[model samples]
Target: MSRIPTRHLGRYLLQGQLPRKGCLASSNYTPRGSCRVAASCSCSRCLQPFSPQATRAVHVSTSSAASPADTPIIPLRKKLKDEAKQLKKESRKNKAQKGSAQTVDGWELTVGIEIHAQLNTSRKLFSPAATSFNDEPNSHVALFDLSIPGSQPLFQPQTLIPALRAALALNCDIQPVSRFDRKHYFWWDQPSGYQITQYYEPLARNGSITLLARDGIAPEDGDSVTVGIQQIQLEQDTAKTLAQPGDARWLDFNRVGVPLIEIITRPEIHHPRTAAVLVRKIQLLLNAVDACVSGMETGGLRADVNVSVRRTGDTATGRLGTRTEVKNLSTIKAVEDAIIAERDRQIAQIEAGGSVVGETRGWTLGSKQTRRLRGKEGEVDYRYMPDPDLGPLLISEDLVRHIKESVAHLPDRELDELVDRYGVSAKDAVSLMALDNGARIEYFYNVVGGLGKRLREAEGRTPQQPLDLELDPDLKKYAPLAANWILHEFGRLVTDRSSPQDDETAFEITPEGQCARVPVASLSELLFHLHQKKITGKVAKELLLALYHGNVGEAGGVTAAIDAHDLWFHELSEEEYGALVESALEGEDRVLKEFGGNKKTYPQGKLMYLVGKMLRLGPTERIDPVNAEKAMRSRIEELCGTSA
Candidate 1:
């Protein structure tokens, strides 16, 4: 017999064979037990006894009176079929009640993510030095981060409150009592032997985030995925390390002690792409709530992708495969790469009839492969006891309720509601919200709403202005028009601050107040110019590009630019359109002869080109092509009558 010492919950058990009392050799072997007979075994030597739990049927087959040794072993196919049927039934029920989920590899992907987002706080966890990202090496290091002798510990409440807000925003269950513990580890950046983290009592738990998938998915379509969130806890981040080409790894203490919130999810993710999309949604949510800065690329938000490939039928009955944790994946592309590589690795191993090993690994972007880093073979003993320096934190129900009410509505949810309630198309709604420039959407609504007010005020006034003003009510009624202008014409005018230098005219965008980098005011101005139609859409784009490139006002009023560009496009319009109409009338004398010869089929294409050319002269003009065509057709009819 073999004995394996294992930890069940918090208790340690020494089972099976033993050598000398002082010897550790005998207890180290793999635990041995057969699945068949162990179901009824009461030895307690091999089986760790369970509490008198309710019994589940232990299936067995009875051989007939014929040769019993020749009896065939029954396959477990029936058991598998029953479970699959139950899963299908449950899935259908859930689809009707909640919604259907996006599945990958024939199994629904349940993703539980613990996002360790670094907070933009001022000081370290236990230090007094100013915490900043790009400070000199060790300059921001306090004695506590340095792990120096005689350095006592202190807590900062400023970091804690923002984390509280984040928890509430994610709809997490805030725990009444929470405390920190030391996570034992050794690293160059971590001068302290252990990292301070929450073990038993996290700050929050049981949260959820619903991500809207792309395409025209109506509420009745019933094909949406809602990922379950497990928890979001506050912890401290470690230091930064820089390695020189020929030098040893250098450590920077500037980032040490920064407050971080780890957002954990239920294993509700299956597809790698869906996982990436979820991360993007979380990033948007955090930004919408002002909980974190928009910097997923700069280590502000990082991902530790845990991937495992199990048999298609295993997950239904709680059977799981050996999982590998891929660390240090920064980009969504890297995530896809990791998933593909890991899936291939698992599939190849299984095809070779080998069992997969559970371990931690690191991704190599260059070769696109995952290499083993470490294994949690015997379970890690972080010795996780509550931190003696920090006392218990009591979060009251009132405090949680307050945070909940204050949490800003997320853009994704708003987009969804807009699509469902306001009849906004999924495509247009997605365009307005998916980008970081949500303020543009807000300004659009404002301008459109203001237009409606102005229209109402004009109803009673003589010689009133056009229905486009700061306080217009008609604009509110024309929200779709506002959406179209913003999405098409107005958006073109504002340079995407994300790629400013690409265009010579775009303004230099910098991070705003440690939040979004783009300027919301720029979008507001563009929308304002569009609503007033002072500048044509084309000229507005040029002006916006120039403004983005730091050009304020070299030209006169916006109407002047519109008038100026109208001339620039005027001659081209006349030449192209007049030539088309004249050529049609002159070359096809038959068309001219049509009205005189009593023939049908007027040259509609030629007439349309003339009208289209006129409209292209300016976006703000709103000239009616139908009316123009009507005037042209009447002149042609009169000219034919006179010639005849």
Candidate 2:
């Protein structure tokens, strides 16, 4: 039996190359998150390829006669039917060519998505059972989760805040009064034979998520596509069925009664990559509000995308063609790849004279293809009804107001502050704050606050107008120096060494449990020195390493950290620096012959390598390398000035 593959969400993504959005979504990506599972887990939900030694079931039907292929559920057009026959015949001699995803004979691929986001609450909804993942199977089930006799569900009001925060961040309108419904189902995992959800009266509606356009413009500054949010409904999740070491399967109700918010998007998406962009946006938003960790391997968030196609001339009001629902995509990359694959599958069918069937398909990571699960069911199949046991959920305007007041500096607002207030690029701000947890976020803002204070002190007031990141004159002075050290340097030091279960714990407090990771003063002092031209970029990086290793003095500041590390850049006398540079050219006869004898250009690398060695200033030395490098270039030009 093959074990399931999952993301090791314990270590956050701190090493991947930054993408277009500046989000480090590479392996264990902060955005396209990697699977994080323990060796003990045996769930095969991901369906990754197994080893040759792994047990797998393969059926071999020994039939002598030729059999027909599985009949396509959706019928084909006469023109397409003939094309498909010819295609099948040609397939014997040559492999089928994959259709171009961007434009398949003028068929426009439109997509919609439904996402399930697990809330990061302490306890499950309507139950006192804990909601931690990977607990011993069946340990967290409450009486309500098990649907025991005389067991009444009691709501946890705190869970509502994350839901509401997501609604506001996604630009959704909150419902003053929402009600719960019982969705009838008979899955073995659901002990109650139904699920409690807000089917009719949801917590919010009319929200929208914006995706950066992929094709025609720069991803950062390009025109964006705004997808409509159908609704965000609050719901109670069902238990998971896990296979035992042998053939037995057990219900792990640890997930039962866990709070979930289902975000359904309107079919406003066209490109396959656009679907991924939207999912990433929501994932980060959920991460921002602490609504969900968005860990796909552990089932914190999952996406179901519906893809369809129509003729090029079809108008926006035209009836939508047949669509296939590819369900249970575990990560942002999975969502993107699945949608693209499905779209191509549909195009191949049509170009070969076939139509698409409306059905539910499951993405198999092992094959990178979608397999038929079952026919797509309509709302009537779920048998939704008002829950008699639970009363209508009442959300007062005052409650929304109160929660809104508390997180005024939430991620979206923080993103805007970095952009409009501090002149940071939209992409850079996202890279700086998007996937990090609350404590790291707190540390992030404190660093930004320190910069803001310094700016105010220098200018005496906020600048009169907002500066775009490209045109901003002041960004080079503060943002680059401050944000780079904090996000990249500090992030790598912490997340790279964090555990596989929870990266958030790494920022909880110092190793001594006194407070969170390095205090703001440490960073403030470091930035102050850099801003004061007392240290070069090289020295700043050395100081950052010192801070990471706890080399700073307890009572002493960044200056003390610097002294202890001997990372000072010394100011060299012009005469001393000039003679030092001249000496680099004097020793090598081949170079000296060139300097006096009209050599077009000296060996820049060899001479600079030696120049860099002699200019190695002492520990307390404080020469600004930015200016020193410029001065070195001028002196080199004078040495080679008169073609002799």
Candidate 3:
């Protein structure tokens, strides 16, 4: 038998590039040059053609004519196909493994988040230049921001107020003494050659946030995850870099030197949804405390997510697998999806006999995947050094105490209170808190308060006193209904009528601007009338729109609006209701034929259709849908011979 080099033999078999002659010995063990396996001929010694196992039995001879270096390179497509096959085989094996069904292909994912939120301040962090988001390019740049010679860093003390509020809101421990350091990096947008940031000593550290199901973040009801805050650092933002066509770029200094607060979280999140929820929770908390303008849409906030995956029972060295960081995830959905995509990518790489590389990646919305951006940067690469101009920051205990006192309850806490105090559902409470930054929540509370006062007055009790909704059943029943009206009816009306604005200036200039057209008292009166059955829900909605569009004057509140529009709910007598029902069903033979029977079941759709026809036959505002349905059901039973 003649021998061939192992590399040549394997490459030939794998690529199907075997020479037509003398590729393999025949079943009779002929000389190498006399046999061919490409045809029907087979080699008993090598088992089969193109089999990976055949490579092991083939012996390599030093006397072979071709050296290993002479072997042909594998094509990219072939390599990809082989990798895909390996990955699929491994996936199937994992599915068959013990406990695979209990986990994500028997692999666990861990994630940590770093968030950079721009502080809501009028001036830059170190320079006195004004800070604005949509201003002209380079208009807000200060001399110091330009990094000209002789320019010195001038620290702004006011920026710390919001930073301190953010730290307190996040439950971080405030550091009495912290200092700024220079993070050295070369980028066109960063003209200073380095960024002034709190590195060695951040503003705060070791805090935590508990995400509750009521907050609508957890995967299941009654599930709560408390993620620990690693640190909160004060930093300066880089200028905006816009890529132009043909490899050109535009730099906007309007965002240069903007104050930023970086909040880092420990690697505690195990699910993609939870990670996204944590980012959203932080944005809400910061917005609630007036700490930062956490608008992901406006680039006011950004998140970097670190994702890694490990086998369920892999305990070697008690270390986790290498992780990849997905950077600059602007939206909450992107954060969750990037983590999931990166996790799957790493798992697939590992399953295909490859190792996960520690690198930086970017999330592509078009493809919904994460692509490699660059290798991850290490601490040493930044070349951190203390800023020469800025000294150690010293905070007085009085200031910390004052800031802590000023910091109201975070969104999660407020959410809990809203659900527990009022009879509102968890879903409704979350919606209230999210709309217009709790402005709607306050409106809802005012409406509830007004209703409570009215109830007290009707009971001949103290009308000006506060009442516990939990103890008073009448007040409890109205809270959820009030939430529904404010969130659904009133909120929808205002949102549709109000023109979209580029910034929050309209909301900030007049906090009550959105709700000013329709007063809380008007909504309170409207909902009260709804509860009293003086008007149906449909009529209430009409009155709401009327009040919003100024068609009805707000001088006398919702009562005046209803009267002006003649939207008062009317109840018909039995005779009148029966006549209307008969007229509605007079010509509708198909509806009756399909649904008419002595069976107990009735076609709800056809019944409602008849009720709708009856409503259209008369003044809808005057007809209560409940009464109309009852009248229609009775008339149908009489005509059709049974109540179906």
Q: Could you say which candidate leads in TM-score? A: 3
Ranking by lDDT: 3, 2, 1
Once fitted onto the true fold, the runs of candidate 1 whose alpha carbons sit more than 4 angstroms away are 1-111, 214-222, 364-368, 376-381, 416-536, 550-557, 563-644
Q: How do the residues 346-420 of candidate 1 rate in per-residue lDDT, one tens digit apiece? A: 767877999778787888775557899997433265666678888887878887777788785766567766555
lDDT of each: 0.61, 0.70, 0.79
In order of appearance, the predictions have TM-scores of 0.64, 0.66, 0.71
Better of 1 and 2 by lDDT: 2
Report the C-alpha lDDT of model 3 over 442-464, residue by residue, as the tens digit.
77777787777676776688643
- Model 2 C-alpha lDDT per residue in residues 103-124, reported as the tens digit of each score: 4567788899999999888988
Kindly report the root-mean-square deviation of model 1 from the true structure over all alpha carbons: 22.8
Model 1 worst lDDT run, 10 consecutive residues: 9-18
Any idea what lDDT model 3 has?
0.79
